[model samples]
Target: MSDQSLLRERWLPGVRELSFGGDYNPEQWPREVWAQDLDLMRRAGVNLVSIGIFSWGLLEPRPGEFDFGWLDEVIEGLHAAGIRVDLGTPTTVPPQWFWQQNPHVRPVMRDGTVLAPGSRGICCPSSPEYAEASLRITTQLAERYGKHPAVALWHVHNEYGAPVSECYCEVSAAAFRAWLQARYGTLDALNTAWGTTFWGQTYGDWSQVGAPAQSASMSNPAHRLDFARFSSDELLGCFTRERDVLHEMSPGVPVTTNFMATNCPSMDLWKWSREVDVVANDHYLTAADPRSQVGLALDADLTRSLADGRPWMLMEHSSSAVNWQPRNLAKRPGELARNSLSHLARGADAILFFQWRASRRGAEKFHSAMLPHAGENSRVFREVTELGATLWSLTDVLSSRVQAPVAILWDWESLWAQDLDWRPSVDLEPRRQVREYYERLWHDKVTVDFAHPTADLSRYAVVLAPASYLLTGEAAANLTAYVEAGGHLVVGPFSGVVDQDDAVHPGGWNGVLRDLLQVSVEEVLPLPENAGVTLTGGTRAGVWAEDLAPQDAETVLEYTDGPAAGRPAVTRRALGGGTATYVSTVLDHHALTAVLDPVLERAGVTIDRDLPWDLEIVSRHGADGSEYVFAINHAGAPVDLPVEGVDLLTGEPCTGSTKIPAGAVRVFRR
Candidate 1:
C-alpha cells in the first residue's frame, strides 16, 4: 500500500469526523455517576473517551494481585453508551504500595536527592524493577480489554518524563555507561568524541562515566549533552516496552502517548514519533506571558509536522483556565472554540481535554474541564457542547491535511547543545531564534511546516534552518542536496559550527555548509546587555554578531556598527539551480523581515499582504475535495477580511470585507 494509505490504516483506521472528548476518569467518581458522564458525553457529541490513564493503584492494589472488576464495568458502560475508548496503560504513576515495596524504584535528582513519591511520574525509567511492574500492568490491561469492541487506541504511559526526567541513581549511571559504550564502541573513541583531554577528565574504563550530575563546577558540555540524550532514550525505552506489550497482546490496536510542548528538554518527540502509531500532545497556555497564545498555535503546528501530515490527536488541553500556572486566568468567551478549532485547522483529527469533569479533590481540583465545578449550567459546559457540535458538523473535513510549501527545521540535539554552559551568549536559545522567524511568517500569512533537518525537502520550495548550531554529517548532506535541487534555503546564525558529538568542525564556520553558504567566519562578537549593532535598511541586530566574509556569495546585509563594523551580516549564494541565504546576526522583527521577505518572494511563496495584524489564516484541503479556510482573529479588536467565502460555521454566504469579532474564529469554505 502507499505510505499515505498505510498511515491512515495503521494509526487511525475508520475514524469518521473529528473525535471530540476528554479524559474520563470514572474511577474518581462513584459507579452511579458514570451513567451521567455518558449522558453528558452524548449531549456534547463526544464519541471517544480516554480512560484509565492513572489508575495503576486501583488496577493492582497490591503486588502479585490484580483487579479488573471495576474497570470492566467502566468500559462496558462506555461501550453501552456508544462511546469508543482509548485505553490507557496506567504506567505513568505506579501504585503507592509498589514503591513502598521497592524503594529502589524511586528516582534521584542531580543533587543526589531522592524524589519522594508525593506526585505523579516519579519512578526512575532506568530501573528494571519499575519497567517490570509497568510491563505487568500493561500486559494485564491489553489481555483484558485489547479485543473488546469498545477499545479504539492503546494509550501508553501518560506524559513520559514530566516531573522527573533524569535520574542520577546507580542504575541510571550504569545504563548511561552502557549506552555510551554502544554508541562509541571503545573508550578511546568516547574520549575523543567528548574532548576529555581538556579538563584532565579522561576515562580509561566505562565505569568511570556517570550521569552528569552535581558537578563542583560547570559540567562538561559533551557529558551533559550525552546525558540529556540518554535520559530521553531511557524514557523512550519505557514507552516502547509498554507499547510492545500492547502490540503483542492486541495486534491491531494502534498505540500512542501524549507529548508535551516542543520546548521541553526531557523527551525528544521527533524520535518518539517514529515509535508510535499516532502522535498525540497535551498543551496548556503560558499564563505568565499574555502574548503566548500565538506560541501555542506554533506548538500545534509543530505537532502536526511530527505526524507527517497524518491526522493526530490533541490529547489534552484545558477547557478554560489551568490551575498549575502562577495566576490561572480563565479563558474569555469564544477562547475555547478558537483554541479547539485552531488545532483542527493544523491537522488534528481529534480535540480532547485533560478531563471530562472537574476534580472534587486533588492537586488539579481547580483545573477546568468539560463539566466544571458549576455543573452543566455553566458557561464552560455551554462552550464545550457548542465546540462539539461544530466538530460533528465538519465530518467532511475529517482526514484532511494541512499543506505548506515552506518548511522550518527544528532539532532537539541542537537545542540541547546550543544553550549549554560557556557559550558565546546566554541568549543563544534555539527556540527563541526560530520563533523570531516563525512569528514573522505567521504575521505575513505564510503557511509553514516544521521539519527535521533530515526530512525530505523535495516537496517544499523554501526551507528555513534557524539556530542550527550542531549539524550531523547526514543532516548537513541532506540540506546541501536540497539547495542543489532548486530549493531555496535560509539558515540562521551559529549554524553548522559543531558536529553531532559537540565537537567543533575543523573547517571555518558553517562546517559542512561552508561551501554551500559561501561564507567563512573569522570571529564572533557577542553584544553585551542593552547593546546592539546598526545595519542597513534601518534594521538593528541585537545579542549576536559574527565577523563574516563572503567567498563565492554576495553580501546582502552589512553590519555598519559594533566591533564587526562593515562586515557581512547576511550573505547569499546561488549554486546548481538553487540559492542559500545565511543570516549572521540576531535580527529584531523588522530586521528579520528585511532579510526574509526577499527570500520568500524569490521562492514564490504566497503571503496575504493585506492580512490584518490581529488576524491569522490557515487553509486545509478536505478529503471530499473541498477547501477550508480558518480566519482566526487573535486580537482584542475585530478584524475585517476583504475576501469572499461561505462561512462554514453559520452556513451564510460571506462576501468581500467580512468583520470577525475579537477572539472569534470564522471557518470559511471556498
Candidate 2:
C-alpha cells in the first residue's frame, strides 16, 4: 500500500455522530404533532434533539417569574421517546422584562448610541446590569436542570455573536477604561503600545480610551480589530460565566454551545473551544454550485479542526433548501443522504436536521422542516426515515472515536491582531487563508486537528499554521518549544507580525520563530486584489504576493515575471530537527497543491498518485494503532478504486479493486 493509504487504514470504525434535531416547538403545535415528528426522527435515524432553542417567550411569560413547564415536558417526552436532549441555556434572548427594567442591560455602540433592540442577543457584556441579570438567569437554569436524567449536555447561548459588536455606552466606556488600565497599566503605557505617538492620537487618560463600537472614525481597522478582540473576549466571558455556573451545579454534564459556521470574524473560536465541554457547530450549506459546495465543505473541516478533532455534533441543518436563500431549493430525494455523508466524510459526529416541524408563522415558517404542514406522509419524510434506518444499522460503529496525528493551529487572536496592525497588507484576511489551508490538507486525506497556538504540539509530527496572525507572548514560546522539540512548522506571509494587543514587536514580530526562520524584513510589499504574481514561471502561482530578503535560507519560488518580479514568493529554512516554510502569496488550488507537495514531502507525508479529480480520499491513524481509509467518489461515473482493503461499514471483505458508486462513501480497513 502507498504511504498515504497505510496511514488511512488506521482511522477506522469511524462513528459519525449527528444531531437529528430542529427547533422542536410542541408549544406551537398540538400533542399529536410530537408523535409524528418522533416517528419521522426514528426513520431519520436521529439519536439526539436540541429542543427549547428559542423558548424564552414560552418558558417565562412574566416578570420575576420562572417557568420551564414546556421545556420540562419536551425533555421528559423525548427521553421517554428514546432521544437524547441537548439542553439550550436560553441565555441568548432574555425575557423582555429583564431588559426593560434594567435598561442598561443592552449594549450601546461606541458613539454612546444605544442599539435598536428587536432581535435576540442585544445585551451588552460590559453593562453591569446586563452581566448581573444574565448570570442570575444562567445560574438559575443550572440550579433547576442540573440533575435531570433527560439532559445529555448543556447548550449555552445560541450563536453567541448576535448583535455583532457590543457596548459603547457610558457603562461600556467605564468598563473599557478599567480593562485597559488592567492591561496597559496606565494611559502612557497604552499610548506606547498602540504607537499613539505616530498620529498624535495617544490617550491622555484611561477614561478617554473607549470601545470602537461604531466609532466616529468609521472604517478604523485598528480600532475595529481591537473592538473585535474585546467583543470576542466579552462573548467568551459570557460563555465562561455560564459554564462556570454549570461546573458548580452539575460537574458531570458536559457544557457546549452551537457555533454558526460562517460566523468567524466576530467570535474567537479558539477561546470558545477551550470553554466548551464538547464543541458544537451549526453547518448551513444550501448552495448548489461546485465552488460554494467546496467552500462550505472546507468550512466544515476547518470547524472540525477548530476543537482539535474531537467529534462535534452537526448541530443544525435544513432538511431541504432553506427559504432564507434568495432562491430556495429543496433537497432531492437522496440529497439529504449526500449532505449527511458529506459531513461524515469530512469529520462530523452526528447527522441532524433543523426545525423538526415546520413553523406555522414567522420568518422561518417557509423554511423546510421534517414534518411539513403536509404531515409525515411526505417525500422528505420517506427519505428521512430511510437514512435514519441506515444509520441505525451502524449504531455508532464509529462511536467513541477520535482524530489522529496532524494538527493545524487556527487562531482568531492572530487574525484580529493582523487586522489591527497599522502597517502591511490590508488584504490579509484571516478567514480566507484559514479556509484555503484547511481545504488543501483535507483534499490530500490528511487527518488534521484544529489546535490553539497555546495547545500542546508534541503529539503531531507536523503542524500547519497558515495564518498565525496573532502570536501572544506565551503562545510564541509554545511555538518555539514545539519547533525546538523537533516538530515541523509552516507559517505563511502576514504571520508572526503582531501581538495580542494589536501591536508589532521591536525585533520583527515573528517572535519565537524569527530566529528559527532566519529571515528578517523591515518592509514587505503588499499586492492588490486581481494582482496575479507568477512565481517560477512554470510551476508556482499566488495572489497578493510579497518579497523577502532571504537570510540563511534557500529561495524556493521566485516571482519570475511580474512588476515586483524576481522577488521571492516562497522560502524555506532548516530549523532545529525540522523545517519552516513561508509562502508569500496565496495560491489557487492547483498552485497551492504544487507548493504544498514539496513541504509535505519534507514532512514525510504523501498523497495517492492516480487519485481521480472528483474523488476525495481521507486517511486517519487511530491512537490505538488502528488505521481506516475513506474514499468518496463525488462524481457521476463509477471509478475503480486502486487500493486493497476490507469494507469497514460492513464486515464484508473487499479485494484489490472496488467500484465506488457515484456520490458514495466507502470505508476500508487493512
The candidate that wins on lDDT is 1
For all predictions, the C-alpha RMSD in Å is: 1.8, 5.5
Candidate 1 local Cα displacement, residue 486, angstroms: 1.2
TM-score of each: 0.97, 0.88
- Residue pairs with backbone overlap in model 1: none
After the best TM-score superposition of candidate 2, give how far the Cα of residue 230 lies from its true spot, in angstroms. Answer: 2.5
Native-to-model Cα distance after best TM-score fit, residue 56 in candidate 1, in Å = 0.7
Task: Report the Cα lDDT for residue 148, model 1.
Answer: 92
Each prediction's number of clashing residue pairs: 0, 28
The digit string of per-residue lDDT tens for model 1 on 135-162 reads 9999888888988988989899888878
Lowest lDDT 10-mer window, candidate 1?
2-11
Candidate 2 lDDT by residue in tens digits, 193-261: 676766567677666777665534434455566667667787888888878788679756777787875
Q: 411 in model 1: Cα distance from truth in Å? A: 0.6
